[model samples]
Target: MGCNPLHALYLGAFLPRPPPPLPPPGGKQDRARAIEAAVMAHWRAVRDWSPSRRMIRLASPDQEQEEEKKRDLPRNVVVEAVQHLLEWGRQRDQVRGEKHRRNEEGLRPPPSSPQSPSGGSSSCPKAPCSEASQPASNSQPSSGETSEILNQESVNSSPAELDSGVSEHTNISSKEKTPSGLSNPHSQKSEITVNERFLKDYNNIECIADGGFGCVYKAHHLLDSTQYAIKKVKWAIGKEEKVTHEVEALAKLSHENIVRYYTCWTGKDIFPSEDSDSSSGEEKLHKCLFIKLELCKLTLEDWIYSEESTKNYKDDAFEKFQEILKGVAYIHEKHFIHRDLKPANIFISFQNIIKIGDFGLVTTGADDIPVKRTRKKGTKSYMAPEQVGQEYGNKVDIFPLGLIWFEMLHRFKTKSEKSKRWEDVRDGRFPPEFIKAFPTEKSIIKKLLSKEPSKRPPAAAILRMLLVHLFRSSSI
Candidate 1:
């Protein structure tokens, strides 16, 4: 997303340009102005796509055509349309060039490199600021520490919230509140609103990244004032009422390794939509929403995929991933599988702790829907066999996590081969020797990578065994 800072710079260049002159009222002038405004507005919609390109298609094209037929544009709307055209032309040119470059190069670029967090590129170092040296405290930790504590806090607070809410299953315990993060006061304010309910007894700061589905900002608590990551998701995509469900699921989830959801809020107000119209659309608006929590710095994928780190830790990314597994094990305990787990979704905090993030694709033990849906979800390369082909359960997550683990542990990238899917992982594609080192847990890993969903270990069971093994190993 930030792979090129030039994109923002280019967009900035055109932003200051004056819109085309408006025609005088009535007669052919009004009609000509109206047609021009409509065309400009349509062009702008394609230019200001959220995060990346796909969002422009969200609006009903048929609706656009119908509206175009009856456009009696006002001067203000014409100005907006012209402004959009200026911006769109610049953006389209930039994207086309980048696409050309990518085609020439064999590999595609990673989204949003650290150098350019706002969809730009910079020659910045991978380690922006060194790890904060404050001793781990009870109240809140650094971004990395916050990741570990978030789930713990969620588990702790879940009981009270769940008591009043309607739920599909009663098996969930109330003891699941993810810990709150502490945000730096010096950070900039986020464009998106952080619900006061979620910010209760906590501190928050400016948002750094806003993707298509959600936005990420830095925040902290009032008590500790430690900085953490706050993610608010756009609710206008499909389901309106499901925002609370996401927040609740986050509230009940806790694990030292898994990124935690501190609190969530959904209310009617002016909010940003994922498919907001660039032209003739006001920014300070709202519809419905939900927010999640965690503490993180960057992702393992960012570290590995970036040219910034290519000269640095290409060899040592494996050990970094093992640390990630420790956290993944923690999440599996509650029987929740992070279906959308990936490098970008995984975050590192101030403490350099690995926290699994993005529970949008999470699936639970209770769902009876054949484990697989027709629509494919999750990252392509890291996807499990069942996720790619058949229906599945929690084990689907384990496969990708394991691939991430393998990449991080071995510091090896998964070679893209047309036929090398998860189904064929057993035959040298994913060597058995990788899992053989950990005797007791090796079976679990193998089962997790199994072609058959029924053969894999449940998240809860995996959590217990890994924690026990990690503890036993640490004690020795």
Candidate 2:
């Protein structure tokens, strides 16, 4: 055996090892074979992992088919769809956060500040008549109620004053102190606490318009017995910066044709208790912004539809159009674009003055250079082609003005007709009636509505043209 050990090792190395005998073909053997097959398949899947394969593995047949269909879509289309989904998810999260916040802190109603003491004569130098000077009766609420109102009013009571340019005759009460600790003899301190006073002074609180951002209330000032409009807007979580920007822009604007911004106030809700259940009990407090603005007799749209305006359209249309141009020119002069200019945003004051309002979408230039807007904002029907989704200058405003001007010149019998006219404008077509009536204006309108923004005239040029037309028409 010892002599044969080396020979046996050599023979073992050369010989192949026999395989294990197969199990008998029975129930247990079959089951074991199936299990082994499944294990091998799973191992293969793990080794060849991919998104599509993983999806196929996890999804139902129907789901997989739907995914396959989506995969066949254009790359850009797929990317846009994904982006839309992501945006929707973000918006949903924001909405949930807003709901949670609203639940925690109840909605704050509009502030009803304490009324100013009555029994004052027309202190305003240019104050209307004695009848208009009468002070409104202040509601005699209890001391505690007054205190609560005062506390709420304190939110926006930071000392601010009306611009002296607003009204030359606006008499500032000697008691009101300026920010510099000096008495401003010209302007009165804009008191947020005086909102209740305004409510007391104004008898009627009629809601003229309701929009997504705010409500417009028509009220009359008891002191001057003059009607005014109050815009009350609800403040959203991320829109504070936009609101602030609008306020700042409006503060700087002081054109006779532009809507006068009297004052603004922010109100917050007073939550009684942190533990108060908003869901089962009462609605939560909502923060809001109140903007006091000059009252107007009618918007340009209303004026256009009014019997008086329609009857004397030929006589007054040019004058009113000139006023509109003046307002827009002033806006441009201030290096701002009245991005949302439309008939609805233009106002006809009681004095027949045309004023531009609604600076919510206004954009300003940096260092007098033109600003480019990337987003498609403003009423789509009135938007210029460049405004739809292109880099545009202030000349973009001219296009809408041209539309408004065209509208002023022609009267549409139906909304359908009006829509058709807008479509025609979009396609660079002017109404035959407008062309026949005003050939010169047609040329101007064509330039204004030009597809190329650079070709459109500046606001100053438009104003000059309007002025020339006014002069010629008046002389004729």
The per-model lDDT (C-alpha) reads 0.52, 0.62
lDDT of 1 by residue, 197-242 (tens): 5445445456677766666767665666567665666566566544
The CA-based lDDT of model 1 is what?
Answer: 0.52
Per-candidate TM-scores read: 0.45, 0.55
Put down candidate 2 lDDT per residue, 1-476, tens digits, no spaces. Answer: 01122222234444444443454577954645543433333333332244565768586978867655653434343333334333434443543454344334433323233234673433432322221344522222344543342233122111110111121122223244333333332432222222343344455566788676666778766456677888766677997877776778889999899999988877743222331655667545557677889988889998777788867687688778888888887888888877788999999988989999988788885323445565887888888777777466677688898888878878787898887667887556887777799887778888888887777887788878877876887799
**Candidate achieving the largest TM-score:** 2
Model 2 reaches what TM-score against the true structure?
A: 0.55
Error of 1 at 262 (Å): 2.2
lDDT at position 165, candidate 2: 14
The C-alpha stretches of model 1 lying farther than 4 A from their native spots are 1-205, 220-224, 267-277, 290-292, 305-330, 366-374, 388-390, 410-448, 455-476
